[model samples]
Target chain A: MDGFIFSLIIGIFIGGVCGYLGTLMLSRKMALTAGPLGHLTLPGIALSLIYGFDVSLGAFPFVILGIFLIWLFETRTKLPMETLTAVVFASGVAIAFLFLPVEQAETALIGNITRVDIYGTIITSILCFLIFLIIRKNYHKMVLINISEDLAKASGINVRKNNLLYLFLIGILVSLGVRMVGGLLTAALFAIPAASSRNFSKNLFQYTNLSIFFGILSSLLGILIYKFTNLPAGPLIISVSSLIFLISVIFKR
Target chain B: MGKLKKQVLKMFAKDKKIILKVKNLTVKLDKEEIIKNLSFEVKEGQVLTILGPNGAGKTVLLKTLLGILPYNGKIEWKINVKIGYVPQRVPFVKQIPISVREFFLLKTTKEEAEKILDKIGFEKRILEKRLGDLSSGQFQRILVAWALVKNPNILLFDEPMTGIDVKGKETIYSLLLKLKKERNLTILLVTHDLNIVFKISDYVICLNKYCMCRGPPIKNVTPKTLQKLYGSKIKFYAHK
Candidate 1:
């Protein structure tokens, strides 16, 4: 496949899955969590830049560590997950700046989708499919837990275990998102489309479907624009999603 | 002949079977005790109502029984017992886009959900409405229906009538009584309505951070006990 085609395929897969997962996050009012977690991938992105490895691979470990810490603190303390994430990610960004190459900073801050090879595309597509399946299976349980922990517990849903798995999934998705939209805008890759979908959706089924549709549309549009304008795909993708969000707001029923 | 009769009566009492036993449960949050030195037992197919004023840890006690909160004590449920819970408030439901149908289908099959909704006297069309759009009464009924869909042996309701109006309250109480009778369910309900306590509950526990009184409602829930449980601020009137 051509370079742009490879990036387009990967972007489409990532966008679809992120949008699906983002519906759960948005419903739980953890939509903004994507932002800080996106930032938390900075250290890994910086390491990837230095070591000549895939950015998503480099971003994985740090985001996972950050997610684990946030989950642990949330269970132990009364503080919310978003607050804990902000604290952890800020430190991560600071550490990232110390080691990141100044010249290649743009690549870390805003991703280079064109750099993705055929092998990378194949691997990411499979990963996206797997993530989508796992999340789909646990989607209802997570929503029920969000509604009421006690009710979920009584329903025989293991709240703590499910929450940990959810956070881990978010960590994985955020890491992959870093390669598409860069560390700075990775949250938008998940959040904007979901938020846009929520405005007009009458039910969760509609909301999730619309979110996935918007996600793919934004990705395809962003990649096309990148091909023509030679602009960064990350910002373009977010810009397209934001445009959709604004339209959704205006046309909200 | 008298000794044989006494033994038979003892065997009958034993056959009732204690389904739940809580021994000296102490729940502390942030090193402050919420439920202290509390002990209670519930037999199968009995309705146990917990009555208390605000901040008396009634909700906390229910949560502890469900094993949601950490408690230092023994809470033993009979093996193979399934519990269904309806919480006091589901504040987040108002903002989500989940339909009533989706909420029910989360933990139950569509057929089971439809059956429960019908049993609760809700129209089939109501299932299409958004959970956030339902009136307080409808939402409460939905919560009840959600709990019943699982066919649990026991139900835990934490202040089921908190936001409901007077008429809705009547319906909820009557519905609870009806469901209890139909399903032979053991219920642990936390509520403040003293009037219905006598009407529905087989047993009542008046609590104020500790167990103030516990027994059959008519025999144990007196005006004096109400005073001790709620302090002199609450005036007790025996509803005929």
Candidate 2:
């Protein structure tokens, strides 16, 4: 496949899955959490740029480490997940700035979707599909936990295990998302489409399905705009999603 | 043996089947004791009401019994027990876009959820309404229906009538009684309503930080026990 086709395919897959996951995060009142987690992927992105490896591969370990620490501290210290994520991601960004080559900084920061080959596209698409399936299976349990931990526990759902799995999934998404939107705008990939969908959706089913629809729509539109305008795909994608959000707000009943 | 003594012996024999046993359950959050060395037991198919004022750790105790919180004691349930819990308030329910149907389906299949809703006399159309759009009373009923959909043998409720009006509260109370009778369910309810304590509960635990009085409400919950539990004067009106 051509660079344009490869980028388009990968972007669609990532955006759709991220948007679907975002519905759960938004419902749990943790929509903005992805922002800090996105930032946490920077050290890995910097390493990837330095070692000449795939950005997603380089981003994976750091985000996983950050997620593990956040999960550990949340359980041990009884601190909120967002609070721990903020602390961890700030440190990650600081470390990333220390070694990030100035020449490759732009690519590391805003991402270059055109750099991926067909192999990378296939791998990412498969990963997105797997993540989507996992989230779909646990969606109701996570929602129940958000509603009431006691209720979830009474229903024989393992709250702690589910929480850890959720954090791990977020880690995986952040790592994969950094390849498309870059570390800075990865959160927008998840948040904006879901937020827009919330305006028109009357129920969870519609909310999730609409979120995925908007995700793919914004991603494809952004890549097409980038093809003609030479603007960065990351910012373009976020901008398109943001435009949708604005229109949603205006048209909200 | 005398006739009364024989009846008492038979009653004791029937109560021998204990479904829950808690010994010295002490819960501490942030190093501050919430429930201190409390002990209680629940018989199968009985209504055990937990009564106390605000900040009295009623919610905490219920959470501990559900194994949601760390507690330093033995909380043993009968083997193969299924519990359904209705929390005091789902504070974020208003912000969520989940429809009532989705909420019910979280714990059960659509057919089971519909059956429970029907049994509760709820309009089937209400299933399409978003959780955020329901009145507090309606939400409370939905919570109850959600609990029942799982066919739990024990139901635990924390201040289930927090935002319900007087008439709504009566409806919920009667519904609870009806459900218990129909399903042979054991209930562990935490509430502030003295009338409910006296009227429906087979056993009452007047708790503050500790168990103050625990027994049949008609025999054990005196005016003095209420004052001690609440740390203030209480106007007692027995509900027959």
Query: Which one wins on DockQ?
Result: 1
Instruction: Kindly state the number of residue pairs that clash in model 1.
Output: 0
- Tens digit of lDDT per residue, candidate 2, span A129-204? 9999999999989988888777788777999899888878888888888888888888888889889999998998
Candidate 2 matches the true fold with a TM-score of 0.92
| Clashing pairs for predicted structure model 1, backbone only | none
lDDT per residue (tens digit) for residues B1-240 in model 2: 778657545654666677788889889998999989898889889999999989989999988888888889888777567888889978777656899999988867888988899999897899999999998888899999988876888999999889799989988989998988898899999999887887789999988898888899998888888888888889987666
Q: What share of the true interface contacts does each candidate keep?
A: 0.74, 0.74
Worst 10 residues of 1 chain A by lDDT: A66-75
Tens-digit lDDT string for candidate 1 (A1-253): 6999999998999999999989888878888777777887888888888989998999898887777677678778869776787787688779889989998788888888888999999999999999999998999999898887778886778998998888888888898888898888988887889999999898989988999999999999999999999989989999999999999999996
Pairs that collide in candidate 2 are none
Model 1, which residues run further than 4 Å from truth?
A72-77, A80-82, B1-13
- In candidate 2, stretches whose alpha carbon ends up further than 4 angstroms from where it belongs are A72-86, B1-16
**DockQ, all candidates in order:** 0.68, 0.65
